[model samples]
Target: MFTSMTVINILLSLVFLYFLGKYLLNMYFEGINRPEQWAGKLKQGKITRELQKAQRQYGDKSRFFLFWLQIERIKKEQIQGTFAELGVYKGDSARILHLMEPTRKIHLFDTFEGFIVADLAKEKGEAASYTPTNFSDTSVDEVKRFLGNSDTFVFYKGHFPESAQSLDTEKYAFVNIDVDLYNPTKAGLEYFYPRLSPGGVIIIHDYSYKWEGLVKAVDEFVRGIPENLVLSPDTDGSVLIIKNSVHT
Candidate 1:
């Protein structure tokens, strides 16, 4: 409707105004409020520091940040049941759970070696292709050493879901799945979900990066049990599912 020069000038002015507003908004947010500073610290340094502190204070052999957090939450809620961990690589997480909730019985499941062909197959879509031949470098022994003669904890050696099925426990307040494969994750869920006490918590490790299978399994599991289950924001690929009520 206007002359070409006028239109061009208006457009340039609008762009300038937009940039100016953006700059002012950014500056305002960056200054006294320092919201971005808090966010930056949370994203860059704080989370890592917290996780590291948890690991160090809890003992590196059997402690991971996500698992420890789950234990704290479970105990705070006063949930009633035993605790179990499937796919205990070196038993660090299980050991931490044992220490955190000393009154509760803790079950540790693992092959004590590295991944089996079946584990690799389910995780990587290729059986035996990615199996680790040497477990000498792994952390299983460290977990054992850390727990050294704990009476409240029991270790079950073998493939999971099967080992879990052998567990006679009728109820569990917490279950941690860290097998890193789809089948084990699925199997663990199937085995433990029914045993979970009302208001219990289930934690799946490696649910994010490097373990898409865990995420998929968790997603599908949550879909099937949407009423009482809630997933946590991803933590070291761990996904937490809290059962707020009984499924009936």
Candidate 2:
């Protein structure tokens, strides 16, 4: 039983309170997060275009921050090892890894024929859900052409582990595991983890709960291992495991 003026006043008051609360909350978080500080830095009195491009490409500050941080760390530590990608379907990510650290040899491993019978068998669901159809579109020549350089490139165009036989003694500073099925994921982890250089990192895509097979593979692989799984909070659901020990 309120007058029209009273109802309007109450509504305005609530709106004001909402804005005030929002401002206070923003201030509180700003103090702790200091996003402004992390977002920009003085590099010859100008913002770095590389950092800006990374932020725009990722569409998330936190994600770009983590990725940039890792690159900087690897460079600073001078982690000596090659770069590798276990699932080089179209060579998109492989291209980026090569550009990221061009001096390091980048190994591309894949069947280029999609999932094998063994990889499909490791999958729990229907074969249709994890079909091995589309990946056959790519080839080693296509990937090499895309990169436009073969000096630092080494393509393992066959089933993994067997394809990886040539790299038995190879050590990697960065390894990207994008093979969707359980078997390849498991095999990639088993092979890469032991050879990861100290301070190097292995980024496993699809570590999020969405990919149950990948989650299971990563979980089982790292069960009793001493290495820590640092999951990214980004939308891509990537988890990075850093090789901290200098020994092995």
Candidate 3:
């Protein structure tokens, strides 16, 4: 009886270990294989320092960090075109793109009045954080100062789709869209996707984030795109859509 009991216990232990190992493997594959999670790993102190050096020499702004990272990656892959960003906010990202690619033009589109407060309020069934008065209080002059007479940067102030429709740009190497709304997100993609240069990148902020509408729009947009366009996620709810060179 004692011998039989020992064998049974040993078998049980083996089964438990097997299950444990399988669980660990699944977790590793699911988490580590994710692009956004991988991007987060690239944000180490060393990477931050290198980015800071590039920014300081070009322009001292936090927004450039993302643009620099993207441009550097694209350059490494030998991609090419001008950069464009929807929703300039304070113009930090646009400033950085201008610095990195001085020869290329950087076009920024924004209402500059915070956001459309009434639309957001209706969506959330309450008063949202953004208000019309917010834009009135903020100033783009400081952001303009970073440009310093550089004509490469252009700002389009107004609602999207309407404002973007007037744009006559032929192609863009990099596009950053941070509209943070279903309609604007959809509009931006529709307006910009056709203009994306071969092997270009479209960076969308707040994609798959906690916000319901943003996630919904991102999911819908990704589903409609071709399979070759890789969607890489970053730590801060950003998704980088790389247009395959052969697609354009």
**Top candidate when judged by TM-score against the true structure:** 2
Model 1, span 75-113: residue lDDT tens: 778888888888777665665666556778888887787
Supply the global lDDT for candidate 1. 0.67
Worst 10 residues of 3 by lDDT: 55-64
What's the C-alpha lDDT at position 163 in model 2? 91
Off by over 4 Å in 2: 1-66, 125-128, 246-248
Backbone clashes in model 1: 4
Where does candidate 2 clash, by residue pair? none
Clashes per candidate, residues 3 or more apart or on different chains: 4, 0, 1
TM-score of each: 0.65, 0.74, 0.66
Candidate 2 at residue 210, lDDT? 57
TM-score of 2: 0.74
The sequence of per-residue lDDT tens digits that candidate 2 reaches over residues 82-112 is 8888999988667656545667788889998
